[model samples]
Target chain A: MSDIEIKDNPDIKSELQTPPEPGYSEWRKDENTLYNDGLPEEEKDWFCDARPQKARKSVQVIENFLNWARSQSLWILAFGTGCGAIELRPLVTSRYDISRLGMQPRPTPRQANLIMIGGYVSIKTLKRIVRSYEQMQGPKFVVAVCSCAINGGMYWDSYNTVKRIDEYIPVDVYVTGCMPRPEAVLAGFNKLKELIKAGKAEGQNLYIERFDWYKENQKKVIKDWNMPDYNW
Target chain B: METLYKELKQYFDVDEFSVQKASLAFLRVPKSQLVSLLTHMKDIRGYTHLVMVTCVDYLEQDSFLLTYLLHNYSTHCDLGIQVSISRQNPVMDGIHHLWEQGRVYQRELFEMFGIDFPGSPDVHEPMILEGWQGPPPMRRDFDTKAYSEATYSHRPRDHKEPEEYMKQQLYPED
Candidate 1:
């Protein structure tokens, strides 16, 4: 019995009709506005934040299901920039069998949502890493694959290596130790999966939002900057 | 090995020559005869295999010893030809012509020690370190740790977050 119904009208017109409260005028961009208390500058997170985030709420059932599906099936990128990448070999092989957890290494960044930064990033390699990170599709995540990613590990005093990976790019998770064992790698993935299920791992969106800050930090170390504005 | 020593004595003007116990020969030649000696070793002595071209900075002597190591596959003997150049101007003859691989080694030496190889074109190009403005790192006076600290930004030194965390962790009672 789909009967026609009339919905109540919003009271925005009535608010517009009311006069300003005793010299409270502060250059009203929207004259019919209901809320006047602006959010504090400190409350806004775009300034000096580690990563960018957007409030994309999954309201519909289909959107919720899609988010669930994305969490369940993550295509990991096979890009390893350091020596720690050797550890990833055993994880994919018969012994570890990471494929059982619905994670497999994808060759192309465009198809993959997960990137494992498998080692120390030199200034030379940082450029390529930035390009590769940017090339990855949205709803992507980053797992810093070693202690080298944390603080350059053994190459701590070396002039060429970058001490921290987070300064240049946002990392969703960090696998500690010089080279974390296959079990540790799996645990790191499990943690990432938990975050992803909760829709907390939004590094890909964060990168896009705070790209200028990331680019500036990148240019400080990389002197010969000749790539395009956006790598994508 | 004995014949190689004999040839070194006959062909080149040398400061000292000796045969080491471990199937090797050592010849310390003057700075002037470096190129000629290397040419002779390559052309006549059949020590065509260029093992390496390295330098050692002797700060006390105020000179840098440029050593050219050559090996003969047939005889299985190593010969180190040494030439000491002034500390002020450590320049050497580019023997990349005799052994083509010497270009890379000399280029690396040039990058690390500022020992100029005049004829090698790659000496001016960027070798191991790109955009290196500081003094040659391998020199005695060029401090590696100081230069490394000054040139690049490290984590704990630049950001004290980890240090503070460690301090809190180590002294939790405090």
Candidate 2:
């Protein structure tokens, strides 16, 4: 007898072809009311609770040019989560000199376009990673380094460590190793550049589209989820 | 160290005097006499530094062996005071009053072993495993492998044994 059931039935489908409400969709939200319910009342004002919106891609020619530019100047947020962070240090030194690839370390997440998830992500660190990933502007990329990030590596059976990082946040590229060498990380950067130039690296947008699924997975592991639903 | 132990034995109920080296020794003290012994060593004897507080779970014995390793900076000697407490009770007298660093160690013991240090500050609060619902993980009975498998989802494993895989790669014809 419900509206959904009526629409599904072939006999009643012809009689009630049109929906009761004109252009009314369950997915649409009232912009003012849809605030992050997770935060305390006093702290709610500190953060923007508006859901993440997908970035509109520009016309093909201009978008391609912009993607090329974005790929060239990849500013990575300097956040080290685990032991794999050791591999990242060598990239800046004279031996590797990652600056030549147009990638440089940025102090804050807001200013950076890329976040390298260096090694295993414990539930505790995953909370911070989610917050930082959310804070970064759209078209942002994640380069998860180490076999630990790829699967779980040595911590596959660990009670504290996360098995797959992608369940919480969308990962664009995975550089595999126990702790991938600096050379392998550079190769990963090159792969990311190729993805960017081809307009394939849309992890930020994919995250927004599958926001609910990611949040559910994140909330399961992170028991003390006291922060706002979206840290924005 | 033997002279020091002999002198202390007359005053306090100390047993099992073990000499690890010329500079290191260990002795067992009853639970009730632990605080007094540590105080006597610190004030009367020259063992002024409290090196560390550690616990070992004896599952078969149903007891937890708590060790308070103390050091004498002047003599360059280490004395470890061992006290065995019941697994059922799992309570210890807080030595936070004697050494401030003992408070942190007590807090860690409380978190890892479910041991209670009633008077110690923030002893009940979680140290590392925040909002952990299960029993104390460091307990011998707590099956970590089972807990991990139940809690976290795993990828379908396509892994082969290293020796066999290496042989296949090196000698494909065979």
Q: Using Cα atoms with residue i matched to residue i, what is each candidate's TM-score against the true structure?
A: 0.75, 0.88
| All candidates: TM-score of chain A | 0.73, 0.85
lDDT of 2 by residue, B50-105 (tens): 99999999999999999999999999999999999999999999999999999999
Per-residue lDDT, model 2, residue B39, is 92
Candidate with top DockQ is 2
Pairs that clash in candidate 2: none
Error of 2 at A188 (Å): 1.3
Considering only chain B, what TM-score does candidate 1 achieve?
0.82
DockQ of each: 0.12, 0.25
TM-score of 2: 0.88
* Reference contacts reproduced by model 1: 0.26
Instruction: Give the winner by TM-score.
Output: 2
Per-residue lDDT, model 1, residue B104, is: 93
* Model 1 agreement with the true structure over B1-174: per-residue lDDT tens digits: 666667677777874777776778788998888888888878877888889888898999999988888998878889999888998987888887777888999889888888888989768887656556678877888776565556455554333456557979899888
